[model samples]
Target: MRIVVAHNRYREAQPSGENTIVDAEMAQLTAAGVEVLPFIRSSDEIPTMPTTAKALLPISPIYAPRAQQELSRLLTEHRPDVLHLHNPYPLLSPWVVRTAHRHGVPVVQTVHNYRQVCSSGLYFRDGMICQDCRGRALGVPAIVHRCYRGSRAQSALMATTLAVHRGTWKSVDRFIALTTAVADHLRDYGIPDERIVVKPNAVPDPGPPAPLGDGFLFMGRLTPEKGLDLLLEAWRRHPVGALGPLRVAGDGELRPMVEAAAAERPDVSYLGQLDRAGVRAAIEASAVVLATSTWHDVLPTVIIEALASGRPVLGTALGGIPYLVGAGTPREPAGTGPASVASAVRGDGAATLPVGVVAGEAGWVVSPDPAALAAALPVARTGAAALAPAARARYERTFHPDVVTKQLIDIYADAARTAPRH
Candidate 1:
């Protein structure tokens, strides 16, 4: 099937998993014998836009005429069977979906973040998960709290964009949610059950399971939301004991704190930001991977990568972490619906929500609080060997490229059938 993949890449200054996922998926499709055409824009290009255009960026999320025209041109020329969208923000707006409809091409969108319901796209504010804007009429609460990049004006513009384009988002042929929890949350927002498809992100298989490594690994942005502080506090309280030191990779605002913790404790080591190879090596060198995010993160690539590397993940029981770690039960964790799901809805949802199988069955899932995580540390260290196989098994069943690509092909075929028969 011929498809057009459209994405607005986040800036590289703070590398994004969305950017990596889009690039990887395109490569996967090509290798799977599908014809893929990329129509991409980057946040890095914002400064190069004309001065007049730069001045209007605050409202660009609502509509970008240039993006519309360019996409229209591509649609007319390529006549793609489907237009697959990832992220369309400041430059490429939701209008692209409308534009695809105008050209008789059906569109499929992937929900990489909570952008439609939250101005910050993270559902996070003040160092906590904040879902105040979910299902709200105008997302006024986001603006009131300066949720987007800590700017009220910017948040207001994003709120306006979300409010105005709600219909455009719902009109897409399909919404590919990164997890079942995310899919359920979309339903709570009134998106139709059939419209949302649960599809987890995949990483290339890093080969057969390697021998269990010593210690654990933490990688990704060193930010509050990522649970950098929470991880350190938990480690300081738990202190690894004798299973080797905790190796940290990645850099951000919390570097000084990480460095300080390293200096103060012999069990913590800050390796700074590692390149892709370094990250892969670290995963193979660790007994478990830490995804200690305190926010409702869509899904951290690290968790999947760790599983692919045959290492179990010990993540907080929040957002997609529980789902990735394969913890909890499948009966739907409590409070995942509109009445209960919140930016700070942590422990309450662990029961009724989808937390998958517990650590022994798959991987570990603990609360984001230091005390909770500290308590689970020993369990992870002790069961690392028994959990390694389950982790890799999960990777093969769900995230293997061949597996995900087959799902993608089916979705593309379904979307193609929905295209206007003009």
Candidate 2:
């Protein structure tokens, strides 16, 4: 099968799960004997773009004429069976959908975030989940709050881009949602159930399960939304060495916060930003992986990585975490903790259901609250060892590259068949 995999990559200085996933997917497809024609743009080029190119950046999101012309020529020449789109922002633009359609090529897009409406793609602002523009015709709230890169002008441009591309997005042949939460978001955005497919991102399996390690590991971009602060608060709530040792990794806006936390307590150790080898090593040395995103993170790849490594996860009940953790089963069969509580209360005074037995194999899920998360840490610590096999099994069945890639190939074939033949 011939497929055009197009994406706009984030800057290299920052770690982007979307970028990593795109690369992995391309490699996986190639290994599976599919011919992948990559059409990629990087944000790092913005700084080095020619003067004229820089001037056109403001309107690129709405329509990148040069990108369209190039893609048009490519489509006309290659005529790939399907054009699978990933991130299309300031460089590629959603015009690729129109371009592919014009060439009679089917277009399949992977929904990476909430960028269809929210300017920042996070649906979060000012340490709170914000979706003020969900059902609106235009994302005026995004412009007002400067949700895109913290620039009012940029946010306005992004909002305009979202407004202009509503039809462009709807016209897509198929939507690959990385998580059920993302699929639900697409439904809420007016996409029909038939057009949307739930396909979670996959990571390379880290071979066989390693021996369970000590303490816990929270690895990702150390940002506020990623739940670094909440993890620290929960860690601090417990006495030192109570829940083994907490090792923090990754670099972001909250590096100082992580450093301070590590300094304040001997149990908390910040490992700084790690390379792939270091990450693997860290995961091998940890028991439970913490994916505590405070926002609606569509699919934080870290959670999948943990599963691949045979490590259980203790993640926030928000976004894709609960879904990733398989929260329906009771860890205790009839208990939330040792006492088997029927329900747990959140910091917001709302009652939430328990996730499996205390050591449900896939770890636990709790509210994003410090208190709720703090209370569950020890339970997870106690249960991490037993959860290894199930965690690895979940990865193989759901997120292993072989499984996800075949599903994607099928989606591509379906999209090609259903599309208007050239």
Which number leads on lDDT? 2
In model 2, the Cα lDDT at residue 232 comes to: 87
Worst 10 residues of 1 by lDDT: 337-346
Q: How far is candidate 2 from the true structure (C-alpha RMSD, Å)?
A: 4.2
| Residue lDDT tens for model 2, 1-422 | 99999999999888898999999999999999999999999999999999999999999999999999989888888889999999998899999999899899999999999998889999999999999999999899998999999899999999999999999999999999888899999999999999999999999878998898999999989778998878888788889988988999999999999899889899889998898999999999999999889898888898899999999999876787777877632333333442343554333343343432222336677767776677778778876776788999999998999999999999999999986653
Per-model lDDT: 0.82, 0.86
| Model 1 vs. true fold: TM | 0.91
How far off is residue 381 in model 1, in Å?
0.8
Model 2 Cα shift for residue 353 (angstroms): 10
lDDT of 1 by residue, 1-422 (tens): 89999999988888688898899999999999999999999999998988988987877799998889999999999899999999998789999999999888989999988887988888778898888887688999998998888898888888899999988887888889899889988888788877788888888878997898888899998888999888887777764456577999888888899899889888888898888898888888889899888888889998989889889998877789888877763222565421222233224343222222235345777666665566567667877887799889989998888899899888889778864542
Clashes of each: 11, 8
Runs in model 2 with CA error above 4 Å? 329-361
